[model samples]
Target: MELEFAQQFVRPILDKISSTPSSSELIIQDFAVIMIVASIMALISYKLKQPMIMAFIIAGMIIGPNTPPFSLITHVEILHVFAEIGIILLLFVIGMEFPIEKLKNVGKKATFIAVAEASGTFMAGFAVTQAMGFTFFDSLFVSLAISVTSTVIIMKVLEELGMIKDEATYLIVGIAVIEDIIIISLLAVLQSVASTGDLTINEVGMSIILVIAFIVGVIVLGSKIVPRCVDLVGKTNHSELLIIAVLGVAFGLSFIAFKLDISVATGAFFAGVLVAESKMRIATKIIATPIRDMFGALFFISVGALMDIKQLPLFIIPAVILIIVSFSAKFITVWAASRAQRLGKTTSLKTGIGLSSSGGELALVAAKGGADVGATSSFVLPMVGAMTIISTFISPYLIKYGWKLASRLESKGTGSSDTK
Candidate 1:
């Protein structure tokens, strides 16, 4: 009897020990490490007068799997999930600030500029990649990936430079909004082409139609319904409830967009627009800002983590070429388009510089799509990732100096006119 009791007790103890979950512990440890590294890098970036996003990315690189000595994150997948949430929240806050009425003001000009820049960049990227001996699909994917500028990077740079209130800022943001819509539609078409090796006219038409319907339905119906719902929640006078309700709407729309094969970022943005229509807009923004900042940092960090530094050297030359081609194409296109719209030389120049930096979340999406369908070369994703990191790193500097250049040009033009 004594021996039986001892065996039973020991068996129970072993079962308990084996059943203890370690994944959760690892996840917690990863988050702690990410925050510590990110904080240190952010402080360093601030001291160097660089964008905090750049610092976060650098921190991610240091602790990421690419850096063997400091690869502290054991659960990269979980970090990606947090990064995605960061994107949704970042776009959501932006949407709240830019409402339907504001969009209407810049709609036509923004659309024209966005289309021109996207087309020009696509052509330039395609030609360059093809000349470098990339396969047809690889060239196509790279071209498409480089065409769209990073909205997140642009917004963050503008905010950091205290240029958020500039007249050119409005136009720049409007163009970004239009580009988001265009890129989402193009991404769908590209995916279809990749999977089937061909794209049908019907597929193209249907994709466009779905995009239009989603935008219209959300704006028209959401404006009417969402505001009232928020108002009802606001009447409750519970700040927590108000925040919860708004977040629910944001996540709900994002989920719906996912189901409809649309980008979740788009849905999150529209959710913000709808919320902006409510009386509680200010309160909603105040509550959402912290959430956005936290997740936004994670998003950029994840971008850096995705970089395989070992593979970068192999693709460095082509990546550099791509960056030059895409940046030059975007700058020229946006500048010419802005001038054509009579936005003034200073505004035009600033707009051009602001939009010059390429590669972003959508570029990554395009790269991943290519990889998933096995239609792109092995170099495609890594090359795009490299471009993203480099472009993002330089975007803040471009904005800061670009403003000075615009001012100088304006002064010179004024002097010439006065002399005349």
Candidate 2:
């Protein structure tokens, strides 16, 4: 009786925290575990010519919340903050890399391509969801979930391959980015509409107007005005001041966007792009580099640490279904778009595979939509994390095989010409 009483009294309390460590000490342990594992795996992935994102994801799966011998770093809020910082710097870096005039060169073809991919993926994901016996809304959510290609990893691969200046590459980037803009804009409206289950055309119109106004307003005002402000801050010429200056710009824009109910990342990206057009662009990167890396590491670490292996069983089918549909959707749309643009077969095939991968940010946006509609919970968010790793791992291999097919086509044409 005494043993039973003690077990009943103390076990629940211990189990709550032990079951899922909310204790600060446990969190610190989580951080240490994440950093060490992430670093080691990153080195391995780098040596293997793969994306570090893949390394991070695999590490996360190994050490996630539901897994046995849970990762040591689970309890730390520090990693969370670091991950957030990583995202900020990442969005800014994306903006910095996109040259404004260069975007003009991709205009019409890029728009058509983006629309085609977004539409195709939506259909495919939705159909698979229905065939798999999920509700229409569920199917829609999951389809949109995996539909878009990841911009960050794709850009890196393209740059490493020395194809950023290639017209086909630009087409992919432009279309993806624009589709991202539309998806996010819809997400903002969806959050409101989902909660109320009420639609007034006037109210919907106003929301659409606000979103458009915000994007246009940022480009016009932010591009011209924000850079000047950063320049003033940078003129101080103190290393510390420059660091503070860049942080201030990122945070200030992010905060403003938040207050206006826009994505902080979109704000950060626009701010960075504007800053890039200015003299202080180099200084901004120099100031932000070390910070970005530290946070970037933490971001991946948190990603690895946050995986809930417990949820894997539930997600197993949906996750696999989501990825397969997403691949088909992106491939057909991009190939058709390439053909429309009169691209050679080589460029068209290359563009299709180059874009088969998905982006983290798009999933972030759609998952938020799922939460807003009560269609998903915190659990669904990490599935996006899983899909990201899987797609990234396979994309490079696909590209490698694609190149060989292209080479064969070219060789056959050469042989035929000689016979003629």
Candidate 3:
């Protein structure tokens, strides 16, 4: 029935439009519609106390090609350009938040926990999927998708809870930074493997070397170059020129990374970090936030737009299974890692729940890479999206109640000790 409907109405229109390119006015109209819908959804999300990112995804679903009544977007390619810009800006802002000196203060314990939890999460994901009879490649994608926590969402929620000053929060943030570096490198390797269908040990080794070299080069060169450039620009005291210079550095490094066949996120992020060293970082972030938010909205919406509701049901069971397994695995792994670091039981629980709360932006980022390389199924985004939504809802509550639960236990233990 749907096929017939598409044949009668959708196909003919698509054919006509494909032959005759859409006018600039039509493209503008399409984008205007997207923004209008997104704005409405954003308001609803605000009222509902949900993440604006979730609202953007919902907006995409309503207008995306995969949903019913055909796609509202005639120019997906153009929208993609906006989405890519959003990603670049998002990473750049993330980088600006972490200066190299700040990273140096992340103790060895945090580093150990980060590695332990990440590796454990990956193994749990891979093992469970394989046990369920998924293909090796499918399992790999699923594992990668589930292994990392969402640093952006977690920090926002922690800030809201006023718990950002806690030791657990610092550990979580430190772990996330490590995860970002590893995951970005992994994405590069996975993309290579996906394209060629084979990756030798030498190739993998070389890729790791290149990744390390790139990061080191960025740190060394960026540290020296960015500060001087910012100082020169700052002498003018011109806000517009400063903004241009900041964005120029951001996009310039991103462009260089792309030309060198690395993840643009890595470049943009390191660029931000380098810029972070300047006395002008706070101002740069202030100027960049509005632009970042706008583009960031479009990027997440693009993720939602790609989701095919019709295809979702087919993958629903697998998605649910993955959600359960991934969530439990992350919680357990993080809890154990925290304990090994000599944190209290309650703190461990909180860390586990905090880390488990949302797959974070990294899940979707990984899903996008999986899809690009054909390393995973088309349902990867929807799967990660569903898990992200569930985790987002549960995370804050866990942070709140988990703390209460932990405190109660601690008090109880103290009372018993006194009685003894």
Candidate 4:
């Protein structure tokens, strides 16, 4: 009887200790592990003067399911929630940085350059893919995939390089905003075409119209209501309450957008714009920055986790070809557009190099959507993911050095002419 009692008492404790963890517990442990690995890699990246994004990605790959020892985290799906949060917060921050006044100032010039560059890239990408003997639909998907720039990568790179104040930066950002809308619309069309075997112009147009109306409604209505709420919340003088309120606005708007079949990032951005218009903007930024950075790290790390380097060998040729063609096409097209806008040759060239990279959240999202609809081949997602990894490493370096290289070449040509 005594031994039986001891066994019964110990068995429950042992079971509690060794039992399979709940999904929620596993997710927390995984996130903790990810943070630890990310910190070390981030330190290394910083010492190497590399972008923190590269570090976070490398960290993700190390702990990803496809990597050695197969994912330290047991429940990846749960972790994806945090990753999505990261994306939402990142977009919110980007939106906060962009206010209505700034957009108004950059409006016409940005629109013209954005249209020119995006169209040029689309045409070039289409031609290149067709030449490679891809099906027309495949070609269309690939072209659209490469045409949109990664606003996240570009904005981060520009901010790191302290080029945000440059005239070219405004245009680059404006172009990205335009591309976001265009890509979303294209994805809608692609989905319809894939599902029904015919393009439904009416449906696509309606979606775009709805998205625009939502944005306008948020800006017009949110500007009036949100600031007043914020002011009342501010009077409470509770920092935590203030942070909560800001996030509520951010995620709440994003949720509505998702429900309406619009891009959540777009919604979050407009929400940020609304918040930015208020006196509480700076305080809101201060409160939200740390949360944003933490989530943003997860977002980039998630990007890395999605990558399977082993699959790269299978699609290596196509991936490499797409990277080269995409980069070259984007550069030439953007350079031409900037020149048409009367930017200096050097500035235009730098802008071209700045916008040359592909593969970002948008590209990955488009590739995934295409694959899901069977509009693209099975190889599309892997190829795009590989291209994004390659381009992520290349873009920052190009943005950092392109201007110097251009100046050096111009000086050499001038010297040669003077000698003559």
Scored by lDDT, the top model is: 1
Which residue pairs come into collision in candidate 3?
Answer: 150-360
Q: Clashes per prediction?
A: 0, 11, 1, 0
Compose the digit string of candidate 4's lDDT tens values, residues 1-420: 988987999878888889998877877898789899999999999898776767887887788887876787676665467677876787687678766776666577667777777778788888888888888778787888888787777778778767777766766777777666566556655654564455468765666577668877988889889878887888888999999998999999988976775556667777788888777888899889999899888877776676677887877888788878888888887877777777776667767877887877667656655655567776676677677777778877776788557657657774121221
Residue 117 error, candidate 1, Å: 1.6
Off by over 4 Å in 2: 1-30, 74-80, 130-141, 155-167, 183-187, 191-204, 359-375, 414-420
lDDT (tens digit, per residue) of candidate 2 on 1-420: 988987999788878767765567676776677777778898999999888777776676566665677544445456556666666777676677654555456588787888888878878877887887776455556667677677777777667666678655766777877776656565555554555555689777776786678767877877787777777877887778867776777777767766665556666666676777667888778768777776666666566566687777887777877887788778888888868777777677767877887646556446645654576556666777777777777776666566456556657773121221
Give the worst 10-residue stretch by lDDT in candidate 2: 411-420
TM-scores for every predicted model: 0.83, 0.80, 0.89, 0.83
Ranking by lDDT: 1, 3, 4, 2
Q: Using TM-score as the measure, which candidate wins?
A: 3
User: TM-score of the candidate numbered 2?
Assistant: 0.80
lDDT of 3 by residue, 1-420 (tens): 999999999999999868855588678978998999999999999999988878998898888988898988877777678877887898888888888998788778778777887778888889988887777767776788888787777888779878888767877888887777677767666665565566688776776677678889989988998978887897888989998998999899888877765667777888898989988898889999999999988888888888887887777787778777777887888888877777777667767877875466667777776776677767677777777666667666766777667657768884121221
Candidate with more favorable, higher lDDT: 2 or 3:
3
Q: Measured by C-alpha RMSD in angstroms, how accurate is candidate 1? A: 4.4
Query: For candidate 2, what is the lDDT?
Result: 0.69
Q: What do the candidate models score in CA lDDT, each in turn?
A: 0.81, 0.69, 0.79, 0.75
